[model samples]
Target chain A: MSGADTVVWMVQNAGSEAGSREVRVCGPALGPDLRLARLDEERLGPYSPGIYAEALSALIAGERGEERERRTIVLLPHTYQVAEFAPLLAVQLGAAYIPSICGAGREAEGGGLRFRRAILQAKLQAEVRPRARTVVATLQSGAFGSDEPPASPTRVVDVCLPADMERSHERQILGREAAGAGGVDLAGAERIVTAGRGVGGADQVSVAADLASALGAELGASRPVVDNGWLPREHQVGSSGHTVAPSLYVALGVSGSIQHLMGMSGSRVIVAINKDPEAPIFSVAHYGIVGDLHEVAPALTRLLNERAARRRS
Target chain B: MLPRRQTGEWGLRIGVCIKQVPDTDAHPRIADSGRHVDDRDVNWVISSCDLCALEEALLLIEAAEQAGGGRPELVAFSLGPARVEEALRKALALGADRAVHLLDDGFQGGDALADGRALAAALRREECDLVIAGAQSDDLGQAATPAVLAQVLGRPYAWLVMAVDLEREHRSVRVLRELEAGMNEVLRLELPAVLAVQAGINKPRFASLRGTLQARRKPLERMDSSSLGLDPESVGKAGAGIETTAIRLPPTGGGGLLIDNASPEAAAAELIAHLEREALL
Candidate 1:
């Protein structure tokens, strides 16, 4: 592998928190494996599509001089795939893409073909692999997994970007913007306590909070909770909210929907607490408790606190 | 409509992502293997809300062109398989100057995240000032793309964009943001960013008599994953990391609770007892 003449590492950098200043051109390898400096080094992010993109740009170019020069970074995108749109899009932009058919069956993991609907409703599953210099990877949602993402110390480079105001999309932005809002950003939390409809209602969310506080974790809610206006939209998890990859995610009273699960399935250790025995959340949960959350949440909180106290003593 | 009145002589290249969804009302037909959806049986329509986003792109191009400015090329990108050509052509016919296709053998299976990755990757080769796409896909309603694509493009972006007004030379944008609680937030975003427009933000127009005719002449581009620099692992099931293992649709909530009532007092007591028995009290 040392025969690698030129080695380049591309990192996704973004806005103020990471501060945009550098430029990474695609070239070679990513050097050494990343060794995280701080266990608390988390990549908490926003959910708004606009903000997410704005922030991501900053992230990719935010690093220092050498880091930016030697890195070939690309931003992680969040968009939908239309069955027929991908091929046509590939040609229009003069870019190549691999498409895939899903929602039908599981991947055999080692195969290249499947025999499903023959044709015309009988479709085969496929993927789009790009054949260009820059690779746009639709990374699997849960690929990042639960962990404190490692951060490497790097040099910062500043580049003056010119104005690109040729479009009619002129909209003056105000308020906090999508970059600096603070709420339940469980996608990057080291530890998270998330509530679902099983939590009963907004009132019971506080109990999840109590548990979160005991664990020094963030509080997150599923879409239902947000829809009812019990929790802020920022706190909603799943496909709509931040796609988190927390180290430890404790699900309280939430019956995991595919959407909700898609967002948090990346968590390292998932402990699901739901009263429903048949709830889908159990399929991927590392640990599960089938009991009323009202009883379980408080009890679990009390137990964790006492354990921490005993350890301190 | 008047590009000359706005930013004189400079132009903007715009991209619109359109999806062809089976009519929302289409029912599922299960075969021996699995459920099959006959898109033909269902009316094929432009993503309901994406029309607004596309119209916005069209207006911007017209405005920029009128300004005697840079060349504004509106390219429509369709992501599905060959079948998506219909939607792609529709976008072109509607007003897009050209079109591109990003479908391939392996792109057929996966979830929203996978789709987003592929689209963003395809966009990397092209240089455009603005990438305008709908807020979400109708079937999955996984409003994840615009943001995720922005992330992939490594550009600043915004979503629920109610309105976008660009001011050239100053490099500023005036935007109306739709808040979750039915409130609207206004913002000014710098250029070279992504924005997911809210549905109904603009009045989407039908193809005009002349415009529809001109669309057929618009050039359409087509490509596959083998052309883009992706992981080469067929993006569909072969490359997928997660396996469904098993999937079961949820059962419809069986009718609900039944309460018996005779006398008013008796009825009240019956409900109370039922609540206690259900541990709902």
Candidate 2:
């Protein structure tokens, strides 16, 4: 039952509001005995992987001072950056890097630290142990409830971007536009209604959209829907797309490929509508309707809209 | 900004790292060893995202050619068993000028870091101005290789790039990166940098029959671990810092109650009632 004496939370403001949520979610993983330290991203400078890695290497090296038996856990907020940064930092600090981690706790038996991560595309969860003295990992969105106790009071370390650290002026910031030509923001949506290939055709997407409008939910879709150009890339939900943990997720005609499951598996309540009773989406759905989405979606929308109109009158 | 030299014979020497993966649509069977899947019978294809990287590389070369600039050489690279040659050949068929195969039995079962070290070594051997690779592999689903390779080569890198524009005269490239919540960050990078490409960047082109024939004559260089001068102790399973103890299917979802009403209205009514009963509405 070895325990870490200090845990460092690395938060990057990659031009998103999820930065603070990342800290709140990862805070509960640390044991009561562990001390907390934070590495805050102070600016939105052009990110050069080499410079970032060098700065982090220096930071970790400075922390590895006289304590021979000390163990440090570094937590990253986003999956993409974690995938990009964790391994490099791990090699630099002689630590073990794990990705898509969902939970962490003290091992029940050995008291050694154990982390849980999904493998095989969220189809399986594995308990991982670090073979090195330092453990570096990234937490999946929606893994931990955000309502947990506030993080411990800790020292905040700001990583100042060196002006000359841009690696021989090889990288520069050009410009950015909101994702999706339609500018859909799925992550912030409380409820999402997603369409899949089973929605039949591009014209049939309106059925799903109508339901979303009636329910006051954001419109999302599976990869095929986006690939087929029925929806923009930003509306896509899957491993390759955006990961969302909305309060309610209503999947229409979705067959639930493992890729799509990886994105919305964290939804608090899942309702699936599909004609195929054998669709994999039913496996995770709390409530399922085995009917054609074209028919069921319109009926559901009308029923809800009628109720709303009646209540207003 | 570095002063641009006169356009030479090659505008940009782009290197793309690719992988051959079992078709995701195939049902994966756990092998007898349980540590990995039995892929002997599965149909192999270029991992989906890698195709996007290839497409992006080809597009850059095409744009350079259309501008009447120097010709760009697109080289595809891969590290895996001999079966990976099929993927490299496909990249050549899709208009890559050449391919490099990092093949060695000793390289099997290596983790991302070990593989990245070997790849970085291979990339060092080529005179490339830009390196592009898929954000992650479909099988392992770990988006670590390109970034780690960038670290090993001491080059700047960006991942999940949605769009790219090259400024040949300025010796820099601009890219749009996808972030969370429908936002993007645009970055400009100097030449000789790496980019981990995401899908949906472009529609990948299929190989024409003539291109398929031409690919046979294209250069396909094969190199082994020893050829790359990698230390034997620093590669393969022994050098992998992480190990998978087991692989198993995820726990099944709690039994889902299905409402199979014959009529659409009935089904909608049942769904609303269920949501209300569960206090989910």
- Per-prediction tally of clashes: 136, 6
Model 2, chain B only, scores a TM-score of 0.91
The reply for model 1, stretches above 4 Å from the true place, is: A1-173, A176-313, B1-8, B35-40, B65-71, B238-249, B254-281
Candidate 1 TM-score restricted to chain A: 0.50
Q: What tens digits encode model 1's per-residue C-alpha lDDT throughout A1-313? A: 3212212222232332121111121111122322111101134222233322233233333432345333222322122322112222222222223222221111355322121111111111222222332222222233232233433424332322214412233333356334214654565678888888778787778989998898788888886677566787677666546667777787887777545766777676677767665565765676656666776677667766775798899
**Recovery fraction of native interface contacts for candidate 2:** 0.56
DockQ metric for all predictions: 0.08, 0.43
Superposed Cα RMSD, model 1: 13.6
Top candidate when judged by DockQ against the true structure = 2
Residue A165 in candidate 2, Cα distance off native in Å: 6.2
Top-scoring candidate (lDDT): 2
What is the alpha-carbon lDDT of model 1 when measured against the actual structure?
A: 0.53
Per-residue alpha-carbon lDDT of model 1 for B1-281, expressed as tens digits?
11211223455566777777766434433333333343445777778657778998888767666665665677677688778888877787788877778888777764444566677776665555678888655554445567657656756566767678766776656677654323456777666667777555667877777877887776777767777766646355544322322212333222323233333334334433443354332
Each prediction's RMSD over C-alphas, in Å, is 13.6, 4.8
